[model samples]
Target: MHLLVTGFEPFGNDQFNASGEAVRLVPDKADGHRITKAILPVSFQRSGEVLAALLQDHQPDALICVGEAGGRDEISLEVQGANVDDARIPDNDGAQPVKQSIVRGGEDYRPATLDPEIILKALHQAGHGAYLSEDAGRFVCNRIAYLAYGQKVPALFIHVPALRPEGQKATVGAETDNREAALKAQPRTSCTLPELAEALTVVLASLADQMK
Candidate 1:
């Protein structure tokens, strides 16, 4: 079996993206399945384009796309993707799409083919902060999730937090200049990059068991 894992590059004022960093941390093999790592752009346009190409090239049995959601304190296993593209900030390409349909004449929304409940359970059993998220947001993560689900592929979108060591304050980059205030408002609830990598590995093992 083969699985394709993807993550997004850093965007905006973020110093580093945990998703991409974790993707790089995933081992080449998990439960006898080969893994392919891919880094996607933080653009609404290019992310989907690149994802489609990867699906074509790898033809993996499953796809797991990861992105950074700064405010979130836990790993979110998104259940569905909305057919909207409302960006709170401009993408890397300076494109801020609002009220835009991801696919013309497509369904309003699509649920991920993967079993989110199972994944959430596995993450929890592994002692990680994991939960099922109803919204994938109107960002590139949702766009790619919608695309992959539309292709009838078993896909999942995971939102991770910024890299932060245990017990230390997590300062997230904000679209506004009030970075310090934002950090103060949002508590320091995050995990290290290695911890996230372990969570992904557990996710893979759980998926492998489910497939069997």
Candidate 2:
């Protein structure tokens, strides 16, 4: 089975993007399967073109896209994408969408059609911390998820958070009261580039089986 995976470059203020790291790491751990990777810029025009080209080139049996979700603390298996576009911050290209639907004339892509029960069971059985999540967020995460759904392929997105660095506190202060000190308190989540790559390999391998 051919698998095509994608990750995005660091967007916004983040210094590191775990999703991109995961995409880079998985192929090394995977043995004896055809896999390809595409790293994307968080731009509206570029994403669709890149995605289309990737699908065309790889002709993959399955598509998996990974992106950073900064604050999320879990391995999220995205379920659906709202016919919405609301960005709190501009993407890496410094252009935010005011009223966009990922696809111009597309309908709400619901996740109810996917066989999550099978995928979820496989993921946990493979020993990775995984869960079925509803929101892929309104950012680039949902954009690609919906595109895959539109293409009549079994596609899904996984979201990882910005890994807290070593020796940091478990929690950071909100603001205005020594945020620098609070930033110092945040504990790292152990979700490193290499670690996420290993986890993604396990997840994708299980998914490829389910595809069969």
Candidate 3:
């Protein structure tokens, strides 16, 4: 099976995005399934456009969109995407949409075709912290999930917890800047980059088995 997996670029004041870094570590193949990976922009407008183009070009058997959820300690298997763009912060392009419909006349919500229960079980068996999430948030992550569900193939969004890079010191007391504050607020619960890659591989392998 061919799987198209996507991750977002670093946004805001952060130096790295967990999703992008983890996807970069993912192998080209998992359980005999071909994995095509792409790093998407954190733009509300262009992300969807790039994803649409990717879907058209690849036409893969499944699509998995991954994003970083800073405060979350576990890997989130999103079940639905809400058709709303309410960004608390500006995207990479400085676009901060407010309570706007992703597709003006679109449904209020779109359900992910991937089975969260199967994926969750696989993640647990692999010793990864994971859970089914109803909220993908109103950021670019949710936007990609919303657009992906509109596609022809099975699709879902996965949210990974923020990981602290090796050798980075914890901030003391008051934050020196917004970047420091953001970095300090992120939970350092997940394993290293290699482990994150392994977790994603487990997900892909499980999905491949399901297809068989």
Query: What TM-score would candidate 2 get against the native?
Result: 0.82
lDDT of 1 by residue, 14-68 (tens): 5577889899999999978999999999888898889989999999888889876
Model 3, TM vs. native: 0.90
Candidate 2 versus truth, CA RMSD in Å, comes to 5.6
Instruction: Report the poorest 10 consecutive residues by lDDT, candidate 3.
Output: 169-178
Model 1 regions more than 4 Å off: 164-188
TM-scores for the candidates = 0.89, 0.82, 0.90
Task: Write one digit per residue (lDDT tens) for candidate 3, span 8-115.
Answer: 887777777878889988899997889999999999999999999998999999998998776666788989998998776788899988889999999999999888
Q: Which stretches of model 3 miss by more than 4 angstroms?
A: 167-186
Most TM-score-accurate candidate:
3
In angstroms, the error of model 3 at 41 is 0.5
Return the lDDT, model 3, position 189: 58
Per-candidate Cα lDDT values, in order, are 0.79, 0.66, 0.82
Please report how far candidate 1 places residue 112 from its true position, in Å.
0.8
- Per-candidate clashes come to 0, 5, 0
True-structure lDDT of candidate 3? 0.82
